[model samples]
Target: MSRLRFLAVPAAALLLLSACGDDDAGGTTSPATAAPTSPAPDAPGTTDASTGPATVALSDDGTHLVSAEGRSLYLFTSDQGTTSACGSGCLENWPPLVAA
Candidate 1:
C-alpha cells in the first residue's frame, strides 16, 4: 500500500504535466470573419448612396438641377426647396455633377 501510494503520486504528477505539454495539434486560428458594414447614417438635410450628379428634382420653371453628395442637393431656389435660379457664379462654387 505504501509503495502504491508513492507510485500513484508520481504518476498523477506526470499525467498532469503531460496533459499540459505544449501541443499545437490544433491549427492556428484564422481571423474571425466580419460581416460587411453598411454606410453610415446621413447627416441633417443630407442624402446617401447617390454619388455624382443626378437630376433630383425639376425646377418650377423646368430647369435641371444636380444633387450634391448624392444626398444633400443644392439647387437655385427663390424659395426654400427650390432649384431654379443658380447662376454661373453659384454653380462655380457648387459645381454640378462634381466628384465628392
Candidate 2:
C-alpha cells in the first residue's frame, strides 16, 4: 500500500548510503555480499515477506551486483557519504530495491 511505498524509499536510501564512505574517495564500490558461484534464482522474491531482509545477488558474469530479479545495480556519484542523491526522475530509471 501507500504506507509501504513511503517506508521503502527510506529503506532504499539507507542501502544506497551504506554503499559509500570517506575511505573510498576513488569511487570504488563494494558488493553488499560476496558473489555466489551459483547462478541467480528465477524470481525476485515473495511480496508477503516484507519482514525479511532485502538481498542482492551476483549476476552471471560476476562483475556486479544484481537484484533478485537480476537487474544490474548502480550507485550515483552525486551521492556523498551516507546520503542518497538519486530521486524523482532519477528513480524512474534506477528504481531502488525495497525489502518487500
Candidate 3:
C-alpha cells in the first residue's frame, strides 16, 4: 500500500507540472482556426497563409511605415537598403514585419 501511494504522488505531481508548462502566447494561428483559403478581393492589403493580411500605413508623424495592426516598422539607418541590422535581442522588443 505504501509503495502504491509513493508512485501515485509523483505521478500526480508530474501531471500538474505538465499542465503548467509554457504555451505560445504570441497569438499564432492554430490549424483549427487557420486563415481562410482566399481573402476578400476588396480587402485593403495582401494576405498570406502564415501572417494573414499585411498593409502599410503612415505613422502619425508621417515619418515611418506602420502595419495595418498599427505596429510601427523601423529601419536602421546603419543598414543599407532592404537589409536588417537588428539582432535577436533587439527583435524581442521590436519584432520583424517579416517572418524569418
Candidate 4:
C-alpha cells in the first residue's frame, strides 16, 4: 500500500508535466498568429468601441482580444478602469494602451 501511494504521486506529477508540454505544442499560440491578418470589417481601422484599437480573434479556447498590430492585449489589475496606476518607471516595463 505504501509503495502504491509513492508511485501514485510520481505518476500524477508526470501527467501534470505532460499536460503542460501539450500547451506549448498544441494549445499555445504565438502573438503574431493570434491577431487578424487584415483590418476588421466595421471600419477602415477600427475594431469596435469596447476594444478600441484592438480587434477580437479566434483561438483554440475561444475568441480573445488583440492589438491593431496583432499583439495580445493584457489588462493591468493595478489600474482603475481606463486610468493607469503604473508610474513612469513601471511603464517602461508595462506600457499603457492609448487610443490611436
Best candidate, lDDT: 2
| Model 4: lowest-lDDT 10 consecutive positions | 32-41
* Highest TM-score against the true fold, candidate: 2
TM-score of 1: 0.26
- How close to the true structure is residue 74 of candidate 1, measured as C-alpha lDDT? 49
Structure candidate 1, residue pairs in collision: 47-71, 50-70, 76-84
Give a tens-digit lDDT track for model 2, residues 5-88.
999999999988887745533343434643332221123332433445557866666677887677987756887664557666
The candidate, 3 or 4, that scores higher on lDDT is: 3
Against the true structure, what is each candidate's TM-score?
0.26, 0.44, 0.36, 0.34
> TM-score of predicted model 4?
0.34
Worst lDDT window (10 residues) for model 3? 29-38
Ordered list by lDDT, greatest first: 2, 3, 4, 1
How would you encode candidate 4's per-residue C-alpha lDDT over 19-72 as one tens digit per residue?
877444335455432322232223233334345343334354535655545445
State the number of backbone clashes in model 4. 0
Say which prediction, candidate 1 or candidate 2, comes out ahead on TM-score. 2
Q: Global lDDT of each model? A: 0.44, 0.59, 0.54, 0.51
lDDT by residue (1-100, candidate 1, tens digit) is: 9999999999999999999997765434322222233332333333443452233433333333323222344433452332334455554555433322
Lowest summed lDDT window (length 10), candidate 1: 30-39
Candidate 4: regions farther than 4 A off? 1-63
Instruction: Estimate candidate 3's alpha-carbon lDDT, on a 0 to 1 scale.
Output: 0.54
lDDT of predicted model 2: 0.59
